[model samples]
Target: MNTEKTSSQPAYEPGGCLTAVARGIALVVVVPVRLVWDALGYCLKHLWRWVLAPLARALGWLIEHLLLIPLRWLWEWLVVPVARALWWLVEHLLLIPLRWLWEWVLRPVARALWWVADLLVVTPIGWLWRHVFAPVGRVVGAALAWAWGIAGRISRAVGRALALVLWHAVGRPLAWAYRVVLTPVGHWLRTYVGRPVAEAARAVRAATREVWRALFGGPR
Candidate 1:
Protein backbone atom coordinates (compact mmCIF):
# COMPACT_ATOMS: atom_id res chain seq x y z
CA MET A 1 0.00 0.00 0.00
CA ASN A 2 2.76 2.52 0.53
CA THR A 3 4.40 1.81 -2.86
CA GLU A 4 1.10 2.19 -4.94
CA LYS A 5 0.12 5.70 -6.41
CA THR A 6 -3.36 7.05 -7.18
CA SER A 7 -4.43 6.77 -10.86
CA SER A 8 -5.80 10.44 -10.92
CA GLN A 9 -2.33 11.76 -10.04
CA PRO A 10 0.46 11.83 -12.59
CA ALA A 11 4.03 11.38 -11.60
CA TYR A 12 5.51 13.12 -14.67
CA GLU A 13 3.22 15.07 -17.01
CA PRO A 14 4.41 15.73 -20.63
CA GLY A 15 1.25 17.59 -21.82
CA GLY A 16 1.46 20.20 -19.01
CA CYS A 17 4.88 21.27 -20.18
CA LEU A 18 3.63 21.61 -23.73
CA THR A 19 0.69 23.84 -22.66
CA ALA A 20 2.98 26.21 -20.73
CA VAL A 21 5.25 26.51 -23.73
CA ALA A 22 2.28 27.29 -26.05
CA ARG A 23 0.97 30.04 -23.68
CA GLY A 24 4.39 31.69 -23.52
CA ILE A 25 4.69 31.70 -27.32
CA ALA A 26 1.19 33.18 -27.76
CA LEU A 27 2.00 36.03 -25.28
CA VAL A 28 5.19 36.81 -27.14
CA VAL A 29 3.40 37.14 -30.55
CA VAL A 30 0.11 38.79 -29.46
CA VAL A 31 1.63 41.48 -27.18
CA PRO A 32 3.63 43.18 -30.01
CA VAL A 33 0.68 42.90 -32.46
CA ARG A 34 -1.71 44.53 -29.98
CA LEU A 35 0.79 47.35 -29.18
CA VAL A 36 1.31 48.14 -32.92
CA TRP A 37 -2.48 48.18 -33.53
CA ASP A 38 -3.11 50.56 -30.60
CA ALA A 39 -0.30 52.88 -31.64
CA LEU A 40 -1.58 53.08 -35.26
CA GLY A 41 -5.14 53.85 -34.06
CA TYR A 42 -3.93 56.62 -31.72
CA CYS A 43 -1.77 58.23 -34.46
CA LEU A 44 -4.61 58.27 -37.00
CA LYS A 45 -7.18 59.74 -34.62
CA HIS A 46 -4.98 62.57 -33.35
CA LEU A 47 -3.46 63.38 -36.78
CA TRP A 48 -6.77 63.98 -38.47
CA ARG A 49 -8.74 65.47 -35.59
CA TRP A 50 -6.02 67.87 -34.29
CA VAL A 51 -3.96 68.76 -37.36
CA LEU A 52 -5.37 67.95 -40.82
CA ALA A 53 -9.06 68.66 -40.26
CA PRO A 54 -8.56 72.06 -38.55
CA LEU A 55 -6.00 73.15 -41.16
CA ALA A 56 -8.37 72.32 -44.03
CA ARG A 57 -11.30 74.16 -42.44
CA ALA A 58 -9.14 77.25 -41.74
CA LEU A 59 -7.94 77.34 -45.38
CA GLY A 60 -11.49 77.10 -46.74
CA TRP A 61 -12.76 79.89 -44.51
CA LEU A 62 -9.80 82.16 -45.33
CA ILE A 63 -10.22 81.72 -49.10
CA GLU A 64 -13.97 82.26 -49.13
CA HIS A 65 -14.29 85.11 -46.67
CA LEU A 66 -11.03 87.04 -47.09
CA LEU A 67 -9.64 86.46 -50.59
CA LEU A 68 -12.63 85.83 -52.84
CA ILE A 69 -15.01 88.28 -51.16
CA PRO A 70 -12.53 91.19 -51.10
CA LEU A 71 -11.57 90.61 -54.74
CA ARG A 72 -15.19 90.80 -55.80
CA TRP A 73 -15.78 93.95 -53.78
CA LEU A 74 -12.71 95.64 -55.27
CA TRP A 75 -13.81 94.81 -58.78
CA GLU A 76 -17.28 96.21 -58.27
CA TRP A 77 -16.24 99.41 -56.49
CA LEU A 78 -12.96 100.45 -58.16
CA VAL A 79 -12.70 98.76 -61.53
CA VAL A 80 -16.31 99.39 -62.56
CA PRO A 81 -16.21 103.09 -61.78
CA VAL A 82 -12.95 103.59 -63.73
CA ALA A 83 -14.35 101.72 -66.73
CA ARG A 84 -17.54 103.80 -66.80
CA ALA A 85 -15.59 107.06 -66.54
CA LEU A 86 -13.34 106.12 -69.47
CA TRP A 87 -16.32 105.26 -71.62
CA TRP A 88 -18.09 108.51 -70.82
CA LEU A 89 -14.97 110.58 -71.64
CA VAL A 90 -14.53 108.83 -74.96
CA GLU A 91 -18.16 109.33 -75.98
CA HIS A 92 -18.39 112.98 -74.99
CA LEU A 93 -14.95 114.13 -76.23
CA LEU A 94 -14.59 112.15 -79.49
CA LEU A 95 -18.11 111.55 -80.75
CA ILE A 96 -19.56 115.01 -79.95
CA PRO A 97 -17.22 116.91 -82.33
CA LEU A 98 -17.88 114.47 -85.15
CA ARG A 99 -21.62 114.79 -84.65
CA TRP A 100 -21.43 118.60 -84.64
CA LEU A 101 -19.45 118.67 -87.93
CA TRP A 102 -21.88 116.34 -89.64
CA GLU A 103 -24.95 118.26 -88.50
CA TRP A 104 -23.73 121.85 -89.01
CA VAL A 105 -21.50 121.63 -92.15
CA LEU A 106 -22.38 118.54 -94.19
CA ARG A 107 -26.14 118.66 -93.80
CA PRO A 108 -26.45 122.33 -94.72
CA VAL A 109 -24.29 121.93 -97.84
CA ALA A 110 -26.36 118.95 -98.97
CA ARG A 111 -29.58 120.93 -98.45
CA ALA A 112 -28.31 123.95 -100.44
CA LEU A 113 -27.39 121.74 -103.37
CA TRP A 114 -30.77 120.11 -103.26
CA TRP A 115 -32.47 123.54 -103.29
CA VAL A 116 -30.40 124.70 -106.33
CA ALA A 117 -31.31 121.56 -108.27
CA ASP A 118 -34.97 122.01 -107.41
CA LEU A 119 -34.92 125.65 -108.50
CA LEU A 120 -33.19 124.98 -111.83
CA VAL A 121 -34.94 121.78 -112.92
CA VAL A 122 -38.06 121.08 -110.90
CA THR A 123 -39.54 124.64 -110.96
CA PRO A 124 -39.52 124.77 -114.77
CA ILE A 125 -41.05 121.28 -114.95
CA GLY A 126 -43.79 122.34 -112.56
CA TRP A 127 -44.50 125.49 -114.65
CA LEU A 128 -44.81 123.49 -117.80
CA TRP A 129 -47.11 120.96 -116.13
CA ARG A 130 -49.38 123.63 -114.74
CA HIS A 131 -49.53 125.94 -117.80
CA VAL A 132 -49.25 123.63 -120.82
CA PHE A 133 -50.18 120.07 -119.84
CA ALA A 134 -53.08 120.83 -117.50
CA PRO A 135 -55.38 122.31 -120.19
CA VAL A 136 -54.89 119.38 -122.57
CA GLY A 137 -55.44 116.94 -119.70
CA ARG A 138 -58.69 118.65 -118.75
CA VAL A 139 -60.08 118.56 -122.33
CA VAL A 140 -59.10 114.90 -122.77
CA GLY A 141 -60.59 114.04 -119.43
CA ALA A 142 -63.93 115.66 -120.40
CA ALA A 143 -64.07 113.78 -123.74
CA LEU A 144 -63.28 110.45 -122.05
CA ALA A 145 -65.90 111.09 -119.41
CA TRP A 146 -68.56 111.75 -122.05
CA ALA A 147 -67.71 108.54 -123.92
CA TRP A 148 -67.69 106.55 -120.62
CA GLY A 149 -71.09 107.93 -119.66
CA ILE A 150 -72.64 106.84 -122.96
CA ALA A 151 -71.12 103.34 -122.66
CA GLY A 152 -72.22 103.05 -119.05
CA ARG A 153 -75.85 103.95 -119.91
CA ILE A 154 -75.98 101.30 -122.64
CA SER A 155 -74.45 98.70 -120.32
CA ARG A 156 -76.93 99.62 -117.59
CA ALA A 157 -79.92 99.13 -119.91
CA VAL A 158 -78.59 95.74 -121.11
CA GLY A 159 -77.90 94.61 -117.56
CA ARG A 160 -81.42 95.53 -116.44
CA ALA A 161 -83.03 93.65 -119.37
CA LEU A 162 -80.93 90.54 -118.77
CA ALA A 163 -81.67 90.66 -115.06
CA LEU A 164 -85.44 90.82 -115.70
CA VAL A 165 -85.28 87.87 -118.12
CA LEU A 166 -83.22 85.81 -115.67
CA TRP A 167 -85.61 86.53 -112.83
CA HIS A 168 -88.62 85.39 -114.91
CA ALA A 169 -86.93 82.30 -116.34
CA VAL A 170 -84.66 80.88 -113.61
CA GLY A 171 -84.66 82.89 -110.39
CA ARG A 172 -88.33 82.45 -109.48
CA PRO A 173 -88.22 78.67 -109.95
CA LEU A 174 -85.02 78.42 -107.90
CA ALA A 175 -86.50 80.53 -105.10
CA TRP A 176 -89.68 78.42 -105.11
CA ALA A 177 -87.74 75.15 -104.97
CA TYR A 178 -85.62 76.44 -102.10
CA ARG A 179 -88.71 77.49 -100.14
CA VAL A 180 -90.61 74.25 -100.80
CA VAL A 181 -88.00 71.49 -100.54
CA LEU A 182 -84.48 72.70 -99.58
CA THR A 183 -85.43 74.92 -96.63
CA PRO A 184 -87.20 72.17 -94.66
CA VAL A 185 -84.37 69.74 -95.44
CA GLY A 186 -81.80 72.28 -94.19
CA HIS A 187 -83.87 72.91 -91.04
CA TRP A 188 -84.26 69.18 -90.35
CA LEU A 189 -80.51 68.57 -90.88
CA ARG A 190 -79.62 71.46 -88.56
CA THR A 191 -81.98 70.19 -85.86
CA TYR A 192 -80.88 66.53 -86.03
CA VAL A 193 -77.36 66.34 -87.46
CA GLY A 194 -75.89 69.58 -86.13
CA ARG A 195 -77.10 69.09 -82.52
CA PRO A 196 -75.83 65.49 -82.30
CA VAL A 197 -72.51 66.40 -83.90
CA ALA A 198 -72.06 69.27 -81.46
CA GLU A 199 -72.86 66.99 -78.48
CA ALA A 200 -70.43 64.31 -79.69
CA ALA A 201 -67.72 66.95 -80.21
CA ARG A 202 -68.28 68.25 -76.68
CA ALA A 203 -68.02 64.74 -75.24
CA VAL A 204 -64.85 64.06 -77.22
CA ARG A 205 -63.35 67.33 -75.99
CA ALA A 206 -64.19 66.42 -72.39
CA ALA A 207 -62.64 62.95 -72.76
CA THR A 208 -59.53 64.47 -74.38
CA ARG A 209 -59.22 66.94 -71.52
CA GLU A 210 -59.52 64.14 -68.96
CA VAL A 211 -56.89 62.04 -70.74
CA TRP A 212 -54.57 65.01 -71.09
CA ARG A 213 -54.87 65.83 -67.40
CA ALA A 214 -54.22 62.20 -66.51
CA LEU A 215 -51.02 62.17 -68.55
CA PHE A 216 -49.58 65.65 -67.90
CA GLY A 217 -51.06 66.47 -64.47
CA GLY A 218 -52.44 69.91 -65.36
CA PRO A 219 -55.43 71.71 -66.82
CA ARG A 220 -56.00 70.98 -70.53
Candidate 2:
Protein backbone atom coordinates (compact mmCIF):
# COMPACT_ATOMS: atom_id res chain seq x y z
CA MET A 1 0.00 0.00 0.00
CA ASN A 2 1.18 3.59 -0.71
CA THR A 3 0.74 6.32 2.07
CA GLU A 4 1.05 10.07 1.83
CA LYS A 5 2.24 12.43 4.65
CA THR A 6 0.08 15.63 5.32
CA SER A 7 1.21 18.85 7.03
CA SER A 8 -1.05 21.36 9.01
CA GLN A 9 1.37 24.38 8.82
CA PRO A 10 0.58 27.53 6.72
CA ALA A 11 2.90 28.97 4.04
CA TYR A 12 5.10 32.00 4.74
CA GLU A 13 6.46 34.55 2.12
CA PRO A 14 9.18 37.23 2.42
CA GLY A 15 8.24 40.91 2.38
CA GLY A 16 8.44 42.73 -0.97
CA CYS A 17 10.46 45.87 -1.86
CA LEU A 18 7.40 48.16 -1.45
CA THR A 19 6.87 46.94 2.12
CA ALA A 20 10.48 47.77 3.06
CA VAL A 21 10.19 51.21 1.47
CA ALA A 22 7.01 51.95 3.38
CA ARG A 23 8.57 50.89 6.69
CA GLY A 24 11.59 53.10 6.07
CA ILE A 25 9.37 56.13 5.31
CA ALA A 26 7.29 55.58 8.48
CA LEU A 27 10.42 55.33 10.61
CA VAL A 28 11.81 58.54 9.18
CA VAL A 29 8.58 60.45 9.85
CA VAL A 30 7.91 59.10 13.41
CA VAL A 31 11.41 59.20 14.98
CA PRO A 32 11.81 62.98 15.26
CA VAL A 33 8.20 63.45 16.56
CA ARG A 34 8.68 60.72 19.20
CA LEU A 35 11.98 62.19 20.32
CA VAL A 36 10.51 65.69 20.57
CA TRP A 37 7.53 64.43 22.60
CA ASP A 38 9.79 62.49 25.04
CA ALA A 39 12.12 65.44 25.49
CA LEU A 40 9.28 67.81 26.24
CA GLY A 41 7.84 65.39 28.80
CA TYR A 42 11.21 65.08 30.54
CA CYS A 43 11.68 68.85 30.63
CA LEU A 44 8.25 69.54 32.05
CA LYS A 45 8.64 66.88 34.73
CA HIS A 46 11.97 68.25 35.96
CA LEU A 47 10.77 71.85 35.78
CA TRP A 48 7.79 71.06 38.01
CA ARG A 49 9.83 68.96 40.39
CA TRP A 50 12.80 71.35 40.89
CA VAL A 51 11.93 74.95 39.95
CA LEU A 52 8.11 75.42 40.06
CA ALA A 53 7.55 73.39 43.22
CA PRO A 54 10.19 75.27 45.18
CA LEU A 55 8.91 78.62 44.01
CA ALA A 56 5.37 77.76 45.06
CA ARG A 57 6.54 76.62 48.48
CA ALA A 58 8.56 79.81 49.04
CA LEU A 59 5.57 82.00 48.04
CA GLY A 60 3.23 80.11 50.38
CA TRP A 61 5.66 80.46 53.30
CA LEU A 62 6.17 84.18 52.74
CA ILE A 63 2.42 84.84 52.61
CA GLU A 64 1.81 82.88 55.79
CA HIS A 65 4.56 84.44 57.85
CA LEU A 66 4.66 88.02 56.58
CA LEU A 67 1.06 88.88 55.66
CA LEU A 68 -1.28 86.44 57.44
CA ILE A 69 0.61 86.43 60.73
CA PRO A 70 0.77 90.20 61.08
CA LEU A 71 -2.89 90.59 60.13
CA ARG A 72 -3.90 87.97 62.66
CA TRP A 73 -1.94 89.70 65.40
CA LEU A 74 -3.51 93.05 64.60
CA TRP A 75 -7.03 91.58 64.64
CA GLU A 76 -6.49 89.81 68.01
CA TRP A 77 -4.63 92.58 69.83
CA LEU A 78 -5.51 96.04 68.51
CA VAL A 79 -8.76 95.81 66.52
CA VAL A 80 -10.62 93.63 69.03
CA PRO A 81 -10.02 95.86 72.08
CA VAL A 82 -10.77 99.07 70.16
CA ALA A 83 -14.01 97.68 68.82
CA ARG A 84 -15.10 96.53 72.29
CA ALA A 85 -14.34 99.93 73.85
CA LEU A 86 -16.22 101.81 71.14
CA TRP A 87 -19.22 99.57 71.53
CA TRP A 88 -19.23 100.11 75.27
CA LEU A 89 -19.03 103.90 74.87
CA VAL A 90 -21.89 103.95 72.33
CA GLU A 91 -24.09 101.82 74.61
CA HIS A 92 -23.49 104.01 77.65
CA LEU A 93 -23.47 107.51 76.12
CA LEU A 94 -25.73 107.60 73.05
CA LEU A 95 -27.97 104.51 73.01
CA ILE A 96 -28.96 104.63 76.68
CA PRO A 97 -29.91 108.30 76.57
CA LEU A 98 -31.88 107.90 73.36
CA ARG A 99 -33.76 104.89 74.74
CA TRP A 100 -34.59 106.71 77.94
CA LEU A 101 -35.81 109.77 76.05
CA TRP A 102 -38.05 107.73 73.77
CA GLU A 103 -39.54 105.72 76.66
CA TRP A 104 -40.12 108.63 79.07
CA VAL A 105 -40.60 111.89 77.18
CA LEU A 106 -41.66 111.19 73.59
CA ARG A 107 -44.07 108.39 74.39
CA PRO A 108 -45.93 110.31 77.09
CA VAL A 109 -46.07 113.44 74.96
CA ALA A 110 -47.55 111.50 72.05
CA ARG A 111 -50.17 109.92 74.29
CA ALA A 112 -51.19 113.30 75.74
CA LEU A 113 -51.54 114.78 72.23
CA TRP A 114 -53.68 111.88 71.12
CA TRP A 115 -55.97 112.28 74.15
CA VAL A 116 -56.37 116.02 73.55
CA ALA A 117 -57.23 115.51 69.90
CA ASP A 118 -59.83 112.87 70.77
CA LEU A 119 -61.46 115.05 73.38
CA LEU A 120 -61.49 118.35 71.47
CA VAL A 121 -62.10 117.29 67.87
CA VAL A 122 -63.21 113.72 67.60
CA THR A 123 -65.68 113.62 70.48
CA PRO A 124 -67.53 116.81 69.54
CA ILE A 125 -67.77 115.80 65.84
CA GLY A 126 -69.12 112.40 66.77
CA TRP A 127 -71.74 113.91 69.08
CA LEU A 128 -72.91 116.43 66.47
CA TRP A 129 -73.16 113.81 63.73
CA ARG A 130 -75.04 111.32 65.93
CA HIS A 131 -77.43 113.66 67.74
CA VAL A 132 -78.13 116.72 65.56
CA PHE A 133 -77.42 115.86 61.92
CA ALA A 134 -78.79 112.34 61.99
CA PRO A 135 -82.21 113.27 63.46
CA VAL A 136 -82.59 116.31 61.22
CA GLY A 137 -81.69 114.31 58.14
CA ARG A 138 -84.21 111.60 59.05
CA VAL A 139 -87.02 114.15 59.56
CA VAL A 140 -86.28 115.93 56.28
CA GLY A 141 -86.13 112.64 54.38
CA ALA A 142 -89.45 111.48 55.83
CA ALA A 143 -91.14 114.80 54.97
CA LEU A 144 -89.84 114.68 51.41
CA ALA A 145 -91.01 111.08 51.01
CA TRP A 146 -94.49 111.95 52.27
CA ALA A 147 -94.77 114.91 49.91
CA TRP A 148 -93.63 112.77 47.03
CA GLY A 149 -96.28 110.12 47.79
CA ILE A 150 -99.04 112.72 47.86
CA ALA A 151 -97.83 114.29 44.62
CA GLY A 152 -97.67 110.89 42.97
CA ARG A 153 -101.22 110.07 43.95
CA ILE A 154 -102.49 113.41 42.67
CA SER A 155 -100.64 112.97 39.37
CA ARG A 156 -102.03 109.44 38.86
CA ALA A 157 -105.59 110.65 39.51
CA VAL A 158 -105.10 113.53 37.08
CA GLY A 159 -103.72 111.21 34.45
CA ARG A 160 -106.68 108.83 34.77
CA ALA A 161 -109.17 111.72 34.55
CA LEU A 162 -107.45 113.11 31.46
CA ALA A 163 -107.54 109.72 29.83
CA LEU A 164 -111.24 109.39 30.49
CA VAL A 165 -111.90 112.90 29.15
CA LEU A 166 -109.91 112.20 25.99
CA TRP A 167 -111.73 108.94 25.39
CA HIS A 168 -115.13 110.61 25.69
CA ALA A 169 -114.34 113.88 23.85
CA VAL A 170 -112.04 112.80 20.97
CA GLY A 171 -111.36 109.06 20.76
CA ARG A 172 -115.00 107.94 20.90
CA PRO A 173 -116.15 110.51 18.29
CA LEU A 174 -113.32 109.69 15.90
CA ALA A 175 -113.86 105.94 16.23
CA TRP A 176 -117.61 106.33 15.70
CA ALA A 177 -117.10 108.49 12.61
CA TYR A 178 -114.61 106.06 11.17
CA ARG A 179 -116.76 103.00 11.77
CA VAL A 180 -120.16 104.43 10.69
CA VAL A 181 -119.75 107.24 8.17
CA LEU A 182 -116.34 106.75 6.54
CA THR A 183 -116.68 102.98 6.15
CA PRO A 184 -119.96 103.24 4.20
CA VAL A 185 -118.66 106.08 2.05
CA GLY A 186 -115.44 104.25 1.21
CA HIS A 187 -117.34 101.07 0.31
CA TRP A 188 -119.77 102.96 -1.94
CA LEU A 189 -116.97 104.79 -3.73
CA ARG A 190 -114.95 101.63 -4.34
CA THR A 191 -117.92 99.81 -5.73
CA TYR A 192 -119.59 102.56 -7.83
CA VAL A 193 -117.20 105.39 -8.67
CA GLY A 194 -113.78 103.65 -8.65
CA ARG A 195 -114.92 100.54 -10.47
CA PRO A 196 -116.67 102.52 -13.23
CA VAL A 197 -113.68 104.85 -13.72
CA ALA A 198 -111.22 101.97 -13.98
CA GLU A 199 -113.42 100.13 -16.46
CA ALA A 200 -113.85 103.26 -18.60
CA ALA A 201 -110.09 103.85 -18.63
CA ARG A 202 -109.50 100.26 -19.78
CA ALA A 203 -112.10 100.63 -22.59
CA VAL A 204 -110.49 103.84 -23.78
CA ARG A 205 -107.05 102.21 -23.88
CA ALA A 206 -108.39 99.26 -25.94
CA ALA A 207 -110.11 101.55 -28.46
CA THR A 208 -106.97 103.61 -28.92
CA ARG A 209 -104.95 100.47 -29.56
CA GLU A 210 -107.46 99.32 -32.23
CA VAL A 211 -107.34 102.71 -33.99
CA TRP A 212 -103.57 102.65 -34.05
CA ARG A 213 -103.56 99.11 -35.40
CA ALA A 214 -105.95 100.05 -38.20
CA LEU A 215 -104.02 103.16 -39.24
CA PHE A 216 -100.64 101.58 -39.25
CA GLY A 217 -99.80 98.00 -39.85
CA GLY A 218 -99.97 95.53 -36.99
CA PRO A 219 -97.38 96.04 -34.31
CA ARG A 220 -93.97 95.81 -35.83
Instruction: Identify the candidate with maximal lDDT.
Output: 2
lDDT (Cα, tens digit) per residue for candidate 1, span 1-220: 5456565566888999999999999999999999999999999999999999999999999998999999999999999999999989988998887799889998999999999989998998899899989988999999999999999999999999999999989999999999999999999999999999999999999999998889888943
Reference-based TM-score of each model? 0.32, 0.62
For every model shown, the clashing-pair count is 0, 0
lDDT of each: 0.94, 0.95
Error of 2 at 165 (Å): 2.4
Which candidate gets the maximum TM-score versus the true structure? 2
**On residues 1-220, what C-alpha lDDT tens digit does candidate 2 reach at each position?**
1233234454454666679899999999999999999999999999999999999999999999999999999999999999999999999999999999999999999999999999999999999999999999999999999999999999999999999999999999999999999999999999999999999999999999999999986965
TM-score of 2: 0.62
Tell me how far candidate 1 lies from the true structure as C-alpha RMSD in angstroms.
29.1
For candidate 1, the lDDT comes to 0.94
Worst 10 residues of 1 by lDDT: 1-10
| Model 1, position 113: C-alpha lDDT score | 90
